[model samples]
Target: MSLFNVFDISGTAMSAQSVRLNTTASNLSNANSVSSSIDQTYRARHPVFAAEMNRATANMDDKASVGVKVLGVVESDKPLTVEYNPNHPMADKDGYIYKPNVNVMEEMANMISASRSYQTNIQIADSAKKMLSRTLRLGQ
Candidate 1:
């Protein structure tokens, strides 16, 4: 793979991580939301990613770097939390309120992981830039 390909790989990775962070944020924001029924409750959303092969390098002898691509965001299939709150205004006829399936601790962990991955990609791009600059200086 060419040294320039590092930038493209890192850029794609950063973009994917940004989406992940955003989804995590959205899930956390709605963690406390209550609904009268399961259909009205929010489901935790997660970003799906897939590695895309570099077409340019596919036919070449050298292995090409794979870029990250976001497949899409999917809602968690886990069951939502059902709480009994007779006094709650939004409670159903059975005095049950529906809560989102989001786990606060899990979302926080996901946020930290996504942020760190994003930072790692930035560092990779910065390192590639420095390497390229040093290579140019060698001709001076």
Candidate 2:
């Protein structure tokens, strides 16, 4: 693969990680939100990613240079947590409050994993740039 391919791959990864971080933050922000009904509660969201293969180049079989693309964002289908809070203003007729299904622990873990992956991609891009620079000096 060409040295420039590294930048494309890493850039895609960084973009994907940014989406992940944003979703994680949104999930965490809504973790404590309460609603009177399940439909009104906020559900955790996550972005789906897919590998974008080069469809334009039929003869070029360079698979290593392909990058990732965000397929879409999906909300969690998990059931909302219901709690009995008669004193809460948003409590339903049965004195139940609906809370988001978001798991704080899982979201935190995802944030850490996404961050590490982003850092790794950055390091790979940096290393590739250093190698390319050294290669340019080889004839000197």
Candidate 3:
């Protein structure tokens, strides 16, 4: 792999982590939201990622590097939280209020992890840049 490829890989990883962070933030924002029905309640969303790769033909076998690819964002299928709150204005006719299935702690953790991953990618790109710079200096 070339030094330039490192930047591309890290850039794609950072983009993927950014999407993860955004989803985590969205989930956290809707964590306390209440609704009268389960369908109307917010659900935690997560981004799916896949490892992109390129394989050479049989005539000339060579491995090609591909960056990270985002599959899609998916909503959590877990059960929504149900609570009996007769006094709540948004309560259903049965005096039940529905809350999002999002877990605040879990979302927070995801945010932290995503942030760290992004930081790591930045560091990787920086290191690659430094290496390339030093290599150029070697010729001078």
Candidate 4:
């Protein structure tokens, strides 16, 4: 791969991480939302990613290489937690309030991971730029 390809790879990674962070933020924001019924409860969402292989080289012999691609966002399949609270305003007839399956600690951990990935990509791109500049200076 060409040295310039580093930028493309890192750029895609950064973009993917941005989407991840956005979804994590959304999940965290709705963590405390209450609903009277399961159907109305907010579900935690996560971004699905898939590696985008190079279409130009259809030959598998080329040693398949890929970049990041966001397949789509999917809701968590885990069951929602229901709490019996008769005093709750959103409680249903059964006196149970539905809460989102989102876990605050998990979301916080994901946020930190995404942030670190973004920073790493930025540093990679910055280093590539510096190296290219230094190479050009050698000709002067």
Judged by lDDT, which candidate is best? Answer: 1
Model 1 CA lDDT for position 47? 93
Query: Mind giving the per-residue lDDT tens digits that candidate 4 earns over 1-140?
Result: 55587787889899999999999999999999999999999999999988776542684665444668898999999999999999999999989999999999999999999999999999998999899889989999
Cα lDDT of model 2 by residue, 1-140, tens digit: 78898899999999999999999999999999999998899999999998776542542665467778999999999999999999999999999999999999999999999999999999999999999999999989
Error at 56, model 1, angstroms:
6.8
Model 2, C-alpha of 22: deviation from truth (Å): 0.5
lDDT of 1 by residue, 13-129 (tens): 999999999999999999999999999999999999988855545756666678999999999999999999999999999999999999999999999999999999999999999
Off by over 4 Å in 2: 54-64
lDDT of 1 at 12: 91
lDDT by candidate, in order shown:
0.94, 0.92, 0.90, 0.91
Best by TM-score: 1
TM-score of model number 3: 0.93
Count clashes in each candidate, considering only residues at least 3 apart in sequence or on different chains.
Answer: 0, 0, 0, 0
lDDT of 4 at 104: 99
Estimate the lDDT of model 3: 0.90
lDDT of 3 by residue, 1-140 (tens): 78887898999999999999999989999999999988789998999998775322332344455778899999999999999999999999999999999989988899999999999999999999999999999988
Residue-level error in angstroms, candidate 3, position 127: 0.4
TM-score of predicted structure 4: 0.91
Q: What CA RMSD would you report for each candidate?
A: 1.6, 1.7, 2.1, 2.2
